[model samples]
Each structure stands twice: as C-alpha cells, then as structure tokens.
Target: RDLNEYLFEPSKLVAKVTDIYLNFAEYDQFCSAVSNDGMSYNEQLFPQAIEVLERIRHPRERIDAFLKLGEHIKTIADQHKEDDVIYNDAPEEYIDQISSILMNDPVMLPSSRTILDRSTVIRLLLDNQIDPYTRDPLHMQ
Candidate 1:
C-alpha cells in the first residue's frame, strides 16, 4: 500500500488496491496509510483511499466521497493552472481544432467551448474579465 501510494497517481483503482493492502497488512503500515500527517506523503493519496473505502461503507457515504474526490481533483488542478499547462494527450485528430490560449496548443477548457491555452487566458483576464466567446464575466478569479 505504501509503495502504491508513492508510485501511482490517485485513481479509483489504485486507491482501492491501496486500501485493500493496507487493511491486509494490519500494522503500523495501516496507520501510516490513513494518517493525515507525513511530509513525504502525497496529501491527495489518503483522501482518495478513504473515498474508495467509503464506496463500501454505506449508501450516502458512497456517493459523497466519490463526488468529493472529483471536486478535490478539479480544485487542485485549477489552482495549478497558472503554474502548469495541462497537456492534452489525445490523438491529434481529437484536439486539432482546439487552439490553446498560450501557443495555440490544442487544449480545450472542460467547462466550456473555450479552446485557448493557460497563458492566453491569463493575458486576456488581465485586460478584460470576460470570456472571449460569450463575453460573460469570467468567474475564475
């Protein structure tokens, strides 16, 4: 479980496997897996593991944990948007029509039809707080 937590990116499959192994290990390692504090640990890993466990916990717990995981991942990604460009690994055909706001890279915004890259969005927001297409007030701030 510890190795999986360190190696794999947080996902439902990885999270579930880690949860199983940690419970199977049944020792300090299990404590380590669930503990919230550890400088070397990925903060997202524990919550992801807990959410995976919650799927079998109870009905309401099952629903909210997964939803919370999605929201958590999105929030973290949004926070990093300025510092990192989210790459689109889809085949060229899929993104060919999408123009990144930065170097016209092929990446589209998930929430809208906006296809601009991160840098372009920053520049545009600096000048005008409106979405390019709808002219709607950019609520990203």
Candidate 2:
C-alpha cells in the first residue's frame, strides 16, 4: 500500500508529521533516504508547514510552540556538538528578562520574562523591519 494513497486528510497528516518532526529532529535524515528525492515528506510539506506556522498569530502561543519545537532540535544539536567537541561551552540560562528600551515595557526574550525568541524577533525584523507587537522599529540591541 502506498503511503501517498492513504486515506488521510492533509491537515491531520500535516499535524501528525509536525508532531513527529518536532519530537524527533532526525526524522528528516532517515526519511530523506527513503524518498525518491533527497527530501523528506516534511520537506515536501514545507509550504503547508509555513502556512501552519504563520497562521499561529498570537505572539505568545507562536513563541511557545516554536520553543517546544526548538527543544527537540536543541537536543539533537547538543548531541552533535558533543560528538564534535568544537567548543566546550557551558550552558547558560535559556531565557533573559529585559525592559524593551524601545517600547519601555517589560518583556521576555527566549529564556526569561518574555516569550519572544530572539531569532524570531530578528527574523521578523529582517522580513518586515517592524516589531510585530508594538509596530515600532525592530532594533536589535
């Protein structure tokens, strides 16, 4: 039976794949090997995945979900770093609290008081040059 022919709704399939990919980052490597092209189903589903990620509009929920996904990637990345031993860097506190000097409001970044991931903020800044929340200048301090 062809997996592609399976009677599954695309949304359900995407959700299941998203969960699996989020839980196990290595799923891509293994899956890519099995596919005709050097890409996994997730890679094929990239457009849909972006849609799903973008549809999550709430900043807190979006950041939280991304962080949850990041945990899986971070675990795998940590193992590879250990194997390579490129840098014996100590783990620092994950989040940081800071008053947004621009907005003058308390906000958390990554590991602390605010939920926004620094990378996400940076990406948003790069893409739009404006803060998603306050619509102010997105400056990286």
Q: What is the C-alpha RMSD of each candidate to the true structure, in Å?
A: 16.0, 16.3
Q: Which portions of model 2 show Cα errors greater than 4 Å?
A: 1-7, 26-44, 53-141
lDDT of each: 0.50, 0.46
TM-score attained by model 1 = 0.24
Candidate 1, residues 4-121, lDDT tens digits: the string is 7677544556555653543444354343333322454455655655665565453464445444544454455454453334544444443423242224444444446656666556
| Residue-by-residue lDDT tens digits, candidate 2, 43-66 | 334445646655643244543554
Instruction: Give TM per candidate.
Output: 0.24, 0.26
lDDT of 1: 0.50
Least lDDT summed over 10 consecutive residues: which range in candidate 1? 94-103
Structural RMSD, model 2: 16.3
